[model samples]
Target: MAKKPLSAWPWENLGSFKYAMYGPLAANVMYSWIYEDSYKHPWCVHILIICALRGFMHQLWNSYNNMLFLGNCRIKQQGVEFKQIDNEWDWDNFILLQGLLATMACLMFPSMDDEFPIWNTKGFITLMLLHVMVSEPLYYWMHRFFHGRYLFTHYHSLHHSSSVPHPFTAGHATFLEHLILSMVIGIPIMGSILMGSGSTSMIYGYVLGFDFMRCMGHSNVEVIHGAIFNKLPFLRYLIYTPTYHSLHHSDMGTNFCLFMPLFDAMWNTLNRNSWQLHNKITSNSGENGRVPDFVFLAHIVDVMSAMHIPFVNRSFASIPFSTRMFLLPFWPVTLMILLMMWAWSKTFLHTFYNLQGRLYQTWVVPRFGFQYFLPFAADGINKKIEEAILKADRMGVKVISLAALNKNEALNGGGTMFVNKHPQLKVRVCHGNTLTAAVIVNEILKDVKEVFLTGSTSKLGRAIALYLCRRRIRVLMLTSSTERFQKIQKEAPADTQNYLVHVTKYQAAQNCKTWIAGKWITPWEQSWAPSGTHFHQFVVPPILASRRDCTYGDLAAMRLPEDVEGLGSCEYKLERGVVHACHAGGAVHQLEGWPHHEIGPIDVDRIDLVWEAALKHGFRPVFQP
Candidate 1:
């Protein structure tokens, strides 16, 4: 239950219980006289108009940005937020009610001893600007904390689900997220009021300007002219562009400023891509009908196995994002980062990517971060996955990646059963396992060259085996199927066959310095190998790595927006950690045309060649930490 508001607060004097339940409706009564022309109709009717205008404004911005892309650079090929099922409700309902409720909160705000319009009083303008200054560091660190492992899985990732953010997405956060962000603005307002230097007009100005800039930040469309940046370079220091904030979302670190770049520049937390993406977009040849087709795939948690219980020692469905937000004020649960890494990983339901028009859908899978990992959930999980893929295929999807457990095959309890189920399915199916395997090899080879490749006959493992051979790295292929194992060896080609050797036992997995395995008919119960050889486990039911000895990561490539490590903040590297992909497929697909990748089949060699092309284009793992 919500705490009872003071009687002095709006409508509480009318007996708190009756009116508390209808507070926002009460605001219509309180503020109705202020808008006499609109009073003839119900408040709901007026709100409908407001929402319509808001939506229209969003469309206008999206259209304007598409045009501006001719002369300006975009942070990504797509900046338009694809409205999703969950987000659609929030956009249509939650925001409307929240805005109506804020009418009363706005009316209750206090005034300072002296007041003046921003234009009339330099003091007011100075104080308004100071609000950003005061809020910047707090917002930065708070944002940093949110990115850390525990809070991110619980709270922050909600906002990030919309990878290609829209203007309204600034408020797509959980309740606790809203509360902390409110402090960024509140502290400055309260500070000025306490110090006796604040004014009503200044307070309103700050609030209005603060929100205006945030909308601009997420707009994905930069309205500011390039001439201003060129002629008055100093102005860039005063405020950040939308490209600045987009990099923060895509890169997951740096550019942690609120409405201004002053603190980010001073603290050395800014990344270089702000200008790179901007210049790259601006340098476009301004060709009509040449804009890229922006398509995205969305998934919550992958269906993977789990080794531990989440909060309350219960299945993840019991603890949801809404419940977590409600509990946030009372308990942050930050301690989980140290004592409960696996539990934390399975705690939150993270919708992995963005959802847009006709593409917004979810399977019958329960809302659990790690539900599919439960002992016997394979059949039900695979059924839902097949249905999702079949639907996407029927709808003319270009390519679909059944992320996490969805990629797992049901035979022998795990592998790619979907691709074979309907080989004729027109839509290209990608587990991203191929590209994922490619990137994992790069990360693993960073320290150790020799390793055991389990599931070497599987599609992903085969690609890894071939790629490793191409690099001349030694591989001990571990597989139980003799025919499949020998096939890999026989087809290994002259150059790679010398580096590849096959064995049919799990025990052989530990002989090498590192162990990289795919989903197996039998599970490797321990988090790490008993021999203490570093294990790079790359399957659903991800191996929880405490130290670096057991490392687990997803298998997809993204073009990082900035250099996360050099951005100079421990919070980001601490929160979500870092995963790198070659992004060769993404860049190559971008060049081929819009709607991203082609509709037909794509191969491992094609993606690997893109990796080579990416290197030639000066692309590398941009996130260091």
Candidate 2:
């Protein structure tokens, strides 16, 4: 039987031989399955079933691999080793599974209409085509937005982490990401079905074909379209080849079409250049592979260097206004040159500073002798402290204590009373404000084997105790202040609760009594005292009896002469002291009795000398390191 072409066809090309054959080839299959009583099962029902089955299989495969697969698979047939390729444990997969199930449910138990009428087949087919046309562009824009910086890090980052994407990576994404993509694709299909003018079967066919195409596009297999189709002027416009879609996955932000290149062409996102590049490279190499590491590194370095320039800085002050106006015409070219020069300068300087040994020796070594000296001092101090603790214990010394003075009090309260402490035992009295206290506690615990804290425990103390316990250090809290000690005990984690032992007033008194009677204790305050009358009074008899290997006398001898004078005066004043200076005539007049303010000119070097002396006496440096 000969079938006549419909006279109402919109385009004459549509009735041509190629269209006549392919159109019916698809149409006949849809019609028989849709209209025949034996095949009356709703097209929507079959689609829902297939989608569910595929989603279930995907989940099952992922679950099995995550739970059971323990080793890498070297596929002999493919001559490749797959490393860490399992996807069953991803959050994306879960969201995808849920979205698919929800979509199927929506299609099956549609809010309206149980069965679609058969009489409106043409209208239904038209609606289905329109739905696809509308949906593809929405997907393109939404997908592009997802790849943008703000959203990409939070949502799209997970997807691109898998550079060589597999089937499981397809639907594996966040719920919000999945929902956005699904609504963009699904709303059109639902809207068409509800309009009641289209063939539901045609819509179902489009959905099935679309899903299969997506899977094949992400598949490992290569299926090039026939050369004749590529050469045919009209047919090329009507269909998408595998090469068309593969380019989309390879080159991001390009080739955003699904079924046809109509929208992609209109939007200028088709990426024909990328396709050409891919074809040229693949033809030569016989493989489509990942980009090399060196190429990626070069791009990163170029980007970083470009971003490093201080664009607002004025190297432009010398140029005349008329010249600047004239240069505005070639501003883009000029700016690019300037930016490139800036990037090169920054890169060269950074590389030389970090990588060139001679530059480091000549520029850095002599200027910062403290950098080399401080580390050696720290290592030596740590070793001597450890040996001292052991020796003190062998001599029957029951307690060895270390103390650091608060920097704030060290300078302001009085002269730095404990400035010359033991050499081997490192002590610094900074104004031990909360921040400094925290830093010191953390640093101190790193070298010590055990720490026994005795004080009215505060939040800072409790925090220090907790941190020490986590590092597996044993801490015994001894304090007469029961409330603060109890707070410390309560805040500690359950596992570390036992490491904190609270000592009562009676217990502390008893321990001190026994140590004093036996002359076996070394108090931290006495151990860290300066070699002056101020700290000599506080040094307990038992501390002196212990016969320490290192003493404050050693530090006092090593001290700068100017520092000793400042300490003597600071200790003489029990209360806070101040040194005042006033300018008179052409010189500065110094006053040291009490606080007073006077305005006058001062000798700059005299002020500098006094400031240096203040710093030696434990005043904080006003400048940054």
Candidate 3:
């Protein structure tokens, strides 16, 4: 008898037909052995179970891999860090997609009725075998097509970005890849339904079985040994192992099997190293050199670039109002072009060596956000900060602190917007406004009973205004609007607003002993008001005040004494022996980053992970990291 010639067409291949028939029938894996109408369970219960299952499996799989260091690769490749990938956000999209799929299934074939008992019996077996057989051929061919040069480069490469594939990596394909992959089950099942041969149990089994098998293939665990295949020789051709898929990842030329290697064998493209590599991996070579270098796919490269668009100052004043208005239709296109140009200008991260007190290394992603001192710039800053959050999330920074414009709510909406945007950031964000405000207020209060506050509507301005107002000190509040003044006035303690003198006039600050100017304060005082008066300016491009008495400071990033904790101050020297807050909330924000408990000492670098650090040293987190 002559062996059949290899063909990409599913009908021409026995393996393809087998995969289609068997993979879906095996979907009984989606149902429980003790079956009942799934409607009996509450929707919340189903959601809870699904969440628990995914969470447990994720942690269990990752923890096991961490211990055994299974299939470890790309830890240090292209600046990728293993710790960075250890994120809660990674599961968010997967869970969402799965939930949607599940809901659709439940809707299409409501699980409310115990209408299908075959899911537990011979019916389950029949469907499992039938779908697997049919899916095999279709899946095999589709899988092969994804490996085509064009598709692989444009779409499938996203999956391969992670040199070391983890369990969740099973669903890490591009939307195009996922769309193509979903057809495997959808087509066959729909075909069966149209022919009046379809059953819910069969569909359930097919989806679950597909999920389980895909997860196993990407697990990187050598559960099926070559020795097992040595004893049970037939299983060798039928069951594809992790080693088979890993080799496919390493070099996409061979071992293309969705379920089995029968067609691969028939095509003469079977990877010979499948079993031997598994042995090496399980034994020493694979385990020893677990980490592999990683490369970025084009899409991610685009996103990383977008995350840090270089700040470029361009004057639009040359264009007439009518000319600019005429270009409004093209403004969006122009803006996007300009943004792309900005993105291409630089990389997302900046590495720096500390030349100050400590000899440690630091990395930063500049906000490049526009108008840090402007209220409306919060939108621009928020967008950039989101990118920074994701970038840091990818790089696995445990803690991040927003600097200058990024830290101000009047500028970036504070850390609240950032945290709200990335729920699973895991890494903490600190505007450090509490500490900055506290320090600046503490220092300024020592010298004056009455202080003039500018930009009172601003976040740090509000914090300072409230603290001073509550302390019963006279605060000459000046803002652009009555609404902003009223807003800050309402936030102050009872009777504190009584001590606040509403002053919309700049000259109202003339009699004040100290002036604390916020970022929103335009046409700020450039000269010393009174001979005896001193000024503390928080916003920068500092007041442009030429007076020797004016001191500019930022308490957000400061160093304190070795023995003191949050009690110490972070003062920037405006003059010799004079340290003050740079922005309205600088000192307060710096304090906000400190640990609540002061058992021993505290130190701060780029970001103060003081809460976690203090916890490790027998101190409970007052302000949790």
Candidate 4:
């Protein structure tokens, strides 16, 4: 490890608490406003607001660039993992430190301390000219100097650690680097102020514009089309694109201009292929390019959970899903977007990651979880699923698994509808319920000889019942239909057939300690379970643990292999690095090179086979307490 720079900031060790550095300054400003003579100036307050605005701008860029629907224009197709996320977690520290430094500079410099009008044309022009003549060259040289041997190893290399740059990557630098950056950035603003041309709007515009360009350069996605530069050829030398900055990271020897290619061109440091690469990325080079090995078809759980998507709020998505009080205020806006999606949006890729050199992606249907339960919305939901499956087939995706309600039996016979409709389709359609049943059954303790099962007539329930009966553990299958019970019972071996006992009332399981809940059970129904019962559930919005004495297992999930890469987001409520069983099942199918479609009924015989395969691939079950 390289030694820490002597210029490191004092609050470097504060972690998230570094924001407290702004507290004393803010309190002083508030005191002046409330009781002191400086109350009328409010320049201090403006500095605070600018700090917040800069942080918000970075977040907006980070979120927007990560949207997978905009994948075609992306300069780097690789995803940022937890390591990069952690490195950039403190990206806003620079903003806070710079705000403090700016406040100090205002107190020290007489010219910058005075207030000016809100808008000044002269100041805006001065800012722009000073930036072009002075700031750009200064930054260009400082950037190049940092890339040299000594500074590169000690400081600038920290910035270069992120191979795939993100918007926050703009601010993720060592203290010494940001200190120099703050000085370089302040030059144009200070020049405008020193010349008596500075105004409120000019400071705001100049600072915000600096942040905007910096973010644009590191966004990883190419938002600027090459056609604009084609029409105005000189503009290429004037403004740098995301691709230009990306080349600097990849090659580390060229494209060193801060926000303009003019300096790079003059210095002969510009990469010859910069414009060509930019055009290639923005134009979507290959018409039929880059197919994933597997696709997990998913849907939104609700308006709040919708915000939990990777592209929306990365920090929130990285952890398990939960309702956040801060997100409640944005619910109305999210609902509006959801409504718009329901009306027109189709299945779109949500995220992708590499596992064992194979690509796996998650594609989401526009419908929310509630829509799947609506009788009127079934046709619309199925239409979206079919469209996704067909698209996957055309892309040569080897396997596509239906997640959550997407594979509900009543809706599509566990994804069998698509296979039968398009019999010649090459992509394998998997409901992944077989492995889901396996995870749930394997969760039962070895010594337990009897289990009470609810939703026994459903696909998973039938498989679970038969699997348990084969193990010689008696299964109290709860169902109203004797014909359905008889059908599942006949599938079991004749010797174990008696173990699959059918019961109509929840009271029949009063003595059973193991309750497998496949359907939602009422509190009254749950009241009959024995005191020590454990509820292993497959039902969505898992049944409330109404029984205080009973323990509840989360929906079946498996931790991804240790070798999985770019898995920065969580799967619904599962823990980090863990995924829902169905998602893992699909991944296992792809990894095993399984040629058969894993749709329709859960084959009782293949339960252990799939479970063993999951274990072999380093996917461990998340056992319940």
Cα lDDT computed for each candidate against the true fold: 0.50, 0.36, 0.49, 0.88
Candidate 4 deviant stretches above 4 angstroms: 1-3, 6-9, 24-39, 109-114, 285-289, 522-524, 546-549
Greater TM-score among 2 and 3 belongs to: 3
Local error of candidate 3 at 351, Å?
22
lDDT score of model 4? 0.88
Ranking of all candidate structures by their TM-score, best first? 4, 1, 3, 2
Candidate 1 segments whose C-alpha is farther than 4 A from its true place? 1-397, 411-427, 446-449, 504-511, 519-533, 546-559, 562-604, 613-625
TM-score of each: 0.40, 0.32, 0.38, 0.94
- What tens-digit string does per-residue lDDT give for candidate 4 at 30-92? 888779877544667888899999988998898787777655577777788888887777788
TM-score between candidate 3 and the true structure: 0.38
Question: How well does model 1 score by local distance difference test?
Answer: 0.50
Question: What lDDT score is found at residue 44 in candidate 2?
Answer: 37
What is the descending lDDT order?
4, 1, 3, 2
Using lDDT as the measure, the top candidate is 4
- Our model 2 lands, by Cα RMSD against the true structure, at 28.1
Global Cα RMSD, each model: 17.9, 28.1, 20.5, 2.4
lDDT of 2 by residue, 1-625 (tens): 3322221112223322422332332454477677765433344344445555555554443332221011112011021011213221342343334334544555576452345654566665665566567777777677778778867767666565544433355554555566665565566556666665645455456555555555444433333334445366565445555456556666778776655666677788877763454344335432332111000000011221222211211112111112334335555654575456434422111000100111110000001112222545433333333343334334333222221111112122211222233233221112112222222232342444455443325333454566666666666554667687776677667887777667543233322211101112345533432232111111111134232433221000011122111011110111112110100100111112111111111112233344443334343321111
lDDT of 1 by residue, 253-365 (tens): 78878767777788787887676665545445242112211122223342121111121211221122222333344333433332253333221221122222112111223
**Model 3 C-alpha lDDT per residue in residues 1-625, reported as the tens digit of each score:** 3322221222223532432432322333344324744534233234345544554555445434332212343111121122223321242344444444544554566543234334345445555565567767777777778788977766667677765555567766665555456566556555554454556556555655566666667664555655687778788788787777878888788887776888688778798887777666555634343121111101111222222211110011111111324335655654575467456532232211111122111223333334344566556546656676566557544345555555555443565666665677654555545545544565564546788887666666776777776677888878768887886677666767787778877787776667777753443454426655555656654555455664543322233223221111111122111122222122222234442211111112211333233223332211111
User: What is the lDDT, from 0 to 100, of the residue 386 in candidate 4?
Assistant: 95
